[model samples]
Target: MDMSTEDDEDEIESAEEEKEEEKESVEAESEVIDETIILADYMRRFETRRMQELAAKKEKAEEKKKQLRYLIGVEEKRKRDVSVETIITPEDELTVSDRVSTESLVHPCLREIDISESQLKILNPYTVYRVPDDPGLSPAFWLLRERPPIYGTDGVQKFYDMVKRAGIRSIASLKDLLITDQIDLRYYGLESQVMRAICEALMDNTYVRKVDLKDNKLSADACKHLNNLLLRNSMIINLSLSGCQIGASGAEKLYNAISTNATLKTLDLSNCNIGNEGFEYIASALSNNQGLESIDLSNNNLDESCAENLRNLLSYNETLTHLNLFWNSLYSAKTWKTLIKGFEKNETLRSLNLSWNGLGVECLPYLSQLLSRSRSIDKLDLSCNRFTEKDAIRIAKALSTNNTLQELYLGNNPVKAEGALALVHAITPHVSPDNVLHLLDLENVWANKDILHELEAIKMLKPEVKVKLRGILSNYQLVGPDIKKILLKRANYEAMAPKIKRRKRNFGHFVMSLSDKMISQEKFMALIKKFKLKLSKSLINEIMLAFEGPRGTVDQGQLKSFYVKEFSEATVN
Candidate 1:
């Protein structure tokens, strides 16, 4: 009975332990379920908030797009409205002061001129713009031209009142006459009368500041009137009498007025028969003068006699920045040496034009010295002068050390391939970093392939340097298929290569007519037009020149074989 009771208690305890295990697992599973529910709810809320923010951003962007489109439409409408022209009445016509105040087109004061008494009807002053500060105002004023074009955009009507009131026709008539060197200029009746009247008109005029009477004939009486006008009008800043026969007497009168005149800044007496005496008078008058900045004495008959006066003027003159002695007779090396001395003292002169002066090998030494040492002369034009390879070498040597010269024009010289290569070597990147030469204008200097390659390499290394070559199409590369297509365009060849006289066939017949089936050099030029090649005449000539045979005739077989060989080589490559 005791054994039975013990077994029963053990079984009961086992049963209770099994029940406790089941209960603990159920509680753990319930807790996991609650955690999963809470996590799922938080994730759903986060997704909703993200979608809401994106939706709001998209709405704002759409609204901004709409506003931008509206503004663009309004701006385009405003432009269309402003572009339409409107007929203006006389009452709407702006007076001079009103125009000046509003920054509008300049017009004469209508109140001063009696519209009824005036023979002319008061047409609307070509009011170009309505806006107070339109940037197109200047272009609009330029478009309204009733008379022929003048120096700049300033119209002829602007000076009509003053010119007509002075009993002169429009100032445009005094445009292109040559003043003689004779002291008695009264015989040039029309020129003198017109010049005097214009001068008289300019005396009271306040608007005309720049007077360009270039290539015009002016008498002694006209010169006197011009002198008086210069004394009276203090606003004339630029005066050009270039290509006029203004003699020593006229130059004296003009420079005497210039000596006292304070407004003239640029004076161009180029091509004005001003000899050494005239230049001396100019130098004497301008030696103490202060207003002039640039003086052009180009094409003047100035010789070595004016060298001393030029040196004196250059030494003392502080304001003169540009001096053009182009096409003068100052070719003597002694004169150049003397001029170099003056340049050494004058630090203000920046540009000097000695082109066409025939300064040969003799003067190269002094010029090279100037290039090596001078700090002011940045531009030097020595084109059309006689310079050889040795001279070019000396100039190159000078350029190797100098840094201030920015422009050097050595065009129209015989600087061969060797000299050009020397120049390239001088300005190489490894030579000096302080080298400032940006423009080397060798416009007519001949160069070979090796020299050109060096120049191209230098240009690639320093992209700022510009080396102008001899021919425009010299360095161009031609494509084989392109040339073939141009030659094979048979339909257009009829027009390009016209039929031979008494023969209905094309240029092939013309080519066959040449002796021994070969075309001479002169006949080869006709083929350029015959080929109808859409290329520059120079380029065509260059290509044709390449096919020339030893006997000075184009080899027909070689000409035909070129494109095929080129095409084959190109394919192989």
Candidate 2:
């Protein structure tokens, strides 16, 4: 019984082990299925990630294509805009007219007309068109007759038909009316008629900014009509009465008009015989007038007193920027001094033209002082003056101190070698590598070889400074190069020679030697020839012989006789 019980326990143990083994086998199978499911899930995730990446790439490519199209569209638009603004031919310019044709009507959406292809040549865009003889007749018919088609009358007819088909009624469109010199009597000789027409045009509100009555025979009555128009007209900006016979009284009336008119900016009274009285009238207007910016009183009979009045006006007026006082005889140094004194206090005076005036050497010192003090005077014209070397030197010194003065005119001033040298020395202190004197008119200054050398030195020192030496004594016969060299060397020697040497024993002997070695007749003649003098041979020989004696042995009688004889001969000549 004990053996059978032990056998049963062993059998029970074996059955329990088999049951545990089956349970482990079932768990392993479950683990394998779980591993397969995990593998499938990983594969599906990878495929989904790849698909997302492909979709992102396609979207990016599409975006790039869209951007490229946008860029191309922008480029095309820029090209079209550029073509619209660019003027291709003479006829592509803007005209003062409004005429429509069939082609323009076809493109009804286009707001702007392209009349660039049309050929209607007209001079003077400010000219007023005369009213037609018959207002009933269409302006287009006259335009067609005046400007015929080069191809044929049939082409003109076709053009007319095109306009008619476009339903363009009353071709007298203000847009098609161009102000040409031929149509406007104002540009020609009909002064009174032009004045009347201009008045009518002003009444009709035709935009006329400028009225050029230049070189016209407009009398006081005509000017009165124009002045009345100017006083009432709001659009006119420039009134040119150049070369007219507007006397002092007329100028006074014009000045009154300018004072009252708010839109007049440029008033040209050039060559109008407006005397000091007329200038005084203008000066009175200049006190309270804020609209007048430019007044050209050139070629008038304005003297020193007139300029004084003008200067006074400038001192008070701030709006007058450009005052052209050219070709007037207000060039006395005292007068300029007074003007510059006033200018120093006035901050608005910019340009003063004193060209062709006789500002002599005596005037330079005071003028230089005045210029140095005046900070507002920027452009000063002292051209065509009788200024000497000393005068130029003083002026240059003043320029060095006057920082506001930019343009200086010294043309035709007879600035020779000495003057140029002085100017070079004076400007050396103020000039720099960057800031330099811009415009220097040294034309016809009678520059010699020495002056040229100084100019070259100035250029080397201040390479940035533009030095203009146009026509610098090109016609005058300068000293020959070799002769100039000798003369310069002699001058240097003379300068370096001892004025008072140390007193040595036998100084008297040295003086005697110098007297013996004094220049001879032959040497003096050679010097005269070297200087290129045109003295007669006989006169030269005589002068040489008379002055040839040794310093101590000079014959005063012979020298006096020769001088008297030469003087008599010169007087006769």
Candidate 3:
């Protein structure tokens, strides 16, 4: 082959190797099991580890940049010192060295406070303090907290009047308000002319980007001020009005403001209790709004009607990418299935979270089927749902044809061994270099060792797909759907009482320790006596006949499950 073709082959191999390395890294680090745990909890661990690693990486990069800057500063200082030696006296050289100290270059943002004792006690020289104790204050709308004295919500009218009344620092201190990154005033419940006052703050100040008024119970009263803030200020992009209890009217006003403001990117109104009408208003606003990218509308008591409004919003909104509708029961059998068409049509949406919705096995086909057809979505989380073996089959079928999906999180689902086997069989044909599923997070789905073995055996088909399987309570067992029907046969034995099956039952623990396979006649008696277990030859034969896989070894999960069934609650003396 030509050099170009050889180079392309090398790149492909390198990419595959990197994918394998990541899978190995995840497998080595993650010990997620215990099938009963929530997917959110499991994912939190994953996210936490990832965040820590990212933070460390970022800190290292920053440190390196700082060192580079320090070195450059030293080199420049040395050059200046050499020039001073040639031109000035020893006293002038000392002055130059003292003036050009490296600390000055270490941080450019740090400034000194040269104000008189009359100035308020701010956190640092860089921070602006809006102290409520000013003598000339006319019913000031700020409550001072100790230690740097940051202002919380007091009232919008007072703020507006404070700005209107001239000689309040002559609007000189307002310059500091422009560049502040965080303006947090949670639970002040300030009303009346707040938006106009904030607009005044935003007129010249360009840096106060985050304004948090959480738990302030902000309503329609404050939305006018919020509307003005949006209309006037383009710098405020991230706004959190969570726990404000902003009702439908306030939401409508906020929606109107959002439609006018193009700078807002991440809007969080979570737990606002905004109902269907409020959602309708927001939907209308989002349909026209272009700059807003992420929205958190969780815990809004939203239902089918609200979901439909969101469906409409997702259909047209191109700039809005991440939509979080967690903890909302926006799905009935028909309602959710209908929404699948909307999900398929929307191409701009990247992350869709329908978690904790009780979308059962039947509902999964609609989503998986949508995945097969849609081209936009890359991350799909169907965790904390009741997934049956049929659900696994449906998802596997979708993965076989779908190409855009990169991450699939199906944790906390009851896709036991049988479902896992069927999923493995379906995914094997599609496990390839170009497979849509790069991260198959099946953590805590009750996959046993045999199920893991079956999946690992199929690595020759595609090693790029990383399957995370294990339960915290499985004692390192492979947890998966018993697709091979090896572990489920003893399920029928539960009808037989423990007393009836006591003598007839196979010694599961004994058989486990003796070669980890179907017990041979040679070691049966010795193994049984050594483990002090009661096991008859007929019982062993019966178990092998019932639950043995192709390799003549019963699945460990099956054996353990059978023992549980045969002796439902019986404990050894």
Highest TM-score, which number?
Answer: 1
Model 3's alpha-carbon lDDT is 0.65
Give the per-residue lDDT of model 3 (tens digit) for 425-519: 55564453356566777777665455656576556666776777665234454678643244333423432325654544444434334443554
Runs in model 1 deviating more than 4 A are 1-190, 471-573
Q: Write the per-residue lDDT of candidate 1 for residues 371-469, one digit (tens) a residue.
A: 899998889998898888888899899998888888989889887877777787788778756888898888877776767666666778899998887
How well does candidate 3 score on lDDT at residue 124?
45
Q: How much does candidate 2 score in TM-score?
A: 0.48
Over 4 Å off, model 2 = 1-187, 203-206, 429-436, 449-464, 471-573
**TM values, all candidates:** 0.52, 0.48, 0.50
Candidate 2 residue 321 C-alpha distance from true site, Å: 1.7
Q: Report the lDDT tens digits of candidate 2 across residue range 1-573.
A: 999999999999999999999999999999999999999999999999999999999999767645643432322112224556666554543332245544335444221422332321223322423444776557767765776434321122333444455444322322222232111223355455444544544533434566676777677777777777777777667878888868887877676677778788888888888889888887888777878888888888887777678777877887776778777787676677667656666777677777765778756766877667876666778888788787787777776666666667887887775676666555553353222455666666555455566566667776665555654444466555543233323433432355454411221121122223346565555644554344456555544444556653333344434434434442233
Please report, in order, the local distance difference test score of every candidate based on alpha carbons. 0.70, 0.61, 0.65
Cα-based RMSD of the predictions, in order? 37.7, 31.2, 43.1
Scanning candidate 2 in windows of ten residues, the lowest lDDT window is: 503-512
